[model samples]
Target: MMACAGGQPGTDAERPVLFSVVTEPIVCCPNDPDDAKTLSDVAGAKIDEVFIGSCMTNIGHFRAASKLLEGKKDMPVKLWMAPPTKMDAKQLTEEGHYGVFGAAGARMEMPGCSLCMGNQAQVKEGATVMSTSTRNFPNRLGRGLLVFSAISDGTQS
Candidate 1:
């Protein structure tokens, strides 16, 4: 936990504080290494699959996604949805967001590191994926995958 203090939180602080201002959404695309690209750079890009769960997502993010998916007739791409915790899944169920996700053809997974880690369910090999996972390292989610690390709203792209 971090607390606000009048001065530095610790006198031994060797690193300077830095602030990142995000005026627009960004996506971390896989390269020979990796690169952070503006969403506009990859607008209208083809995404074979999407994973919407990780430590980066919360109940609010799910709710917002549900709103976007609600009443949709068809989902063109494969969509995977998972909550970070059982409690969040329960809450979303109670709030009917789960129903919305289901109506949109989402494949729900067990909470906690579901598709975020290579150990659990993974997108098809060689598929391009937009994920809320922490990193887009090769094979982190699946073999031969071109992973893009982005926030929940990155799904809009």
Candidate 2:
């Protein structure tokens, strides 16, 4: 299983339940993590913005994103990138990932909780966003935002 969950020990739901058998990467729909679907499910869907950051993401994720965006310029959607820490940002800069992000017209956010907590940066109102944030509850990031949460590779940011 790609994801799993279980209740507390000595309770009625002690055994872990298989959450999903994801053969490939999956993404959660807006406002509902349980409403998971494969990337193909959202094919041809309009994405107004893309966010590849927050606490849930790691250096590897950013590296993968950079690799995908290598030599690309003028991204179709508004792309936001933020590493989990200043150290990650530094490493990506040293590795030239920052240049890739810039070439793609991605907005480089501060290294920490950029758009995940709804505190630092926020997407456009009523925008459809593909994100790596941990959650996609209503109004968490912005008013009337439709946030689809997924791993970096799944979203292909």
Candidate 3:
């Protein structure tokens, strides 16, 4: 049993406990040669397009990326942003992030589940993509192999 913030005390049984079975291989970041390749690796090996936004990505991440991409707009890399919601897209637009994107030679898409929904743009075969999307399973994006890494502790990085 745990004390409630303002309501009546609650018991552990009152909570809707959820559990799942592990069915996939869990590995650490790409730097682990025994595991997958890091973002720095396998990048540019054959990838031509890059995606930088998803439900996992937020305004702060966009801002940080914009700052890092300042004054450089000719890297020959295609950068795309798919805002999770219209409101988020609007907020980002109003905050001049679009301008930063433009200056950085980036593009934005309509609010949609470009990655999660699996009904939008897809990575081409034999192409590499650097994405911030959460659904990076085998061939989830397209015919090309989908690979990604995360914090060794199973936390968002």
Candidate 4:
């Protein structure tokens, strides 16, 4: 990577080659409030699976997720948590945050780029996922649209 010093940085050699093109928008959700939405329409929406992992989320995010999972029994959401680093997983496990996820029937994966790349773990087709990754590119998690969520002010998780 070159540092931009007043002028533009990358040369023709630095540019990446294109593969397949995506004509559709990365996120497919409707902007209209009249349509279904997050935390409400998606809540108890009978998602086929769920994945929660990324460098974007820290211990606080996991805690917030646990807060939301609290008191909810018989959850049909197939939850997965794959922290970006081993230390993050360790800390969460130490602080009992992982237990919260475990109690909620969420599986914990070894810290790495698991579902983010559709590599290590993959969600089923026709599933809806809420993630914490910066990009919601098509199939970034799996074969479904991704919603990037963070615990906002006065929000649960």
Candidate 5:
């Protein structure tokens, strides 16, 4: 999880910090390369959705996803990437990172809490979602929505 500027808790007077949270590979994890062996091992799996934009998902996330999808164009994962701010989105797009994600069959969205907030677009009931946002609680985004923090680079979750 790459923590970018924006989405920090504070007012305009507060300073922002950039950091990333990575986690070690857990045994029996579905996305674990040691267990899966190939992208097809997880392709077309039951994934409710994927939220790729947030303080946890920076350019590194895009690059990782791109590499994962390399030579596996038919991956079956519904991906929605939302940069923490419009500026991040613009810079990423300008740098051609957006194309990398798109080539991997991921959709790019505007910067905002599109799914993290129950009021915004809500996740389907009992749907399994992977996100880069912090916190995972009942009805935090929607009732019974299973939200998992995406671990990137086999270090951050």
Candidate 6:
């Protein structure tokens, strides 16, 4: 596996580079009726996955998704929550937010480098994954994988 040293930049030959973009905060879900008409209006496309984890996604993120799915219940997108630490997962579950996520078809994973490491229990080959992780490189997680950086507003694959 390719690994980057602390603050050390890798050359183009050494690194398997991937395209990425910085997007505006996702104030609402992409499927929300009031949001932008298309992804182009909010951000570019070619997204693979939608991640709802990492240190940046706080309780508020879950709350927002939960609220968005309230009453409607059956959310259309597939959401994966990977908290930065075990503590965060416990807090979310203890606070009864897990049910909300579950109701909306979201999966709460253990707090560790699971999917981000390219070792998810069920990722298919040639899958394009959108993530909140900091890096976007080839084979960083899975062989022939395509990874995309996530926006703050919760928009994901």
Question: Which structure among the candidates has the greatest TM-score?
Answer: 2
Model 1 clash pairs are none
- Candidate 2, residues 18-66, lDDT tens digits: the string is 5454466578888776567678987777899998888778888889888
- Candidate 3 Cα lDDT to native: 0.58
In candidate 3, what are the lDDT values of residues 1-157, reduced to their tens digit?
A: 2212212236443323122333343322222223443345443455466676667666667676677887877868677777777887788789887788888888777776774444686666655555666656556556654434231222322
Question: Between prediction 1 and prediction 4, which has the larger TM-score?
Answer: 1
Query: Clashing pairs in model 6?
Result: 25-153, 26-153, 48-128, 49-130, 49-157, 50-157, 118-141
TM-score of 4: 0.61
Full-model lDDT for every candidate: 0.79, 0.82, 0.58, 0.60, 0.57, 0.56
Ranking by lDDT: 2, 1, 4, 3, 5, 6
Worst 10 residues of 1 by lDDT: 13-22
* Candidate 2 TM-score versus the reference: 0.83
Off by over 4 Å in 3: 1-46, 149-157
* Cα lDDT over the full model 5: 0.57
Judge candidate 1 at residue 13 and give its lDDT: 35
Deviation in Å, model 3, residue 84 alpha carbon = 1.6
Give the winner by TM-score: 3 or 4: 3
* Candidate that would win on lDDT: 2
lDDT of 5 at 3: 27
Candidate 3: worst 10 consecutive residues by lDDT?
25-34
lDDT of 2: 0.82
Work out the TM-score per prediction: 0.80, 0.83, 0.62, 0.61, 0.59, 0.59
In Å, residue 112's CA in model 3 sits off its true spot by 2.9
Q: State the TM-score for model 6.
A: 0.59
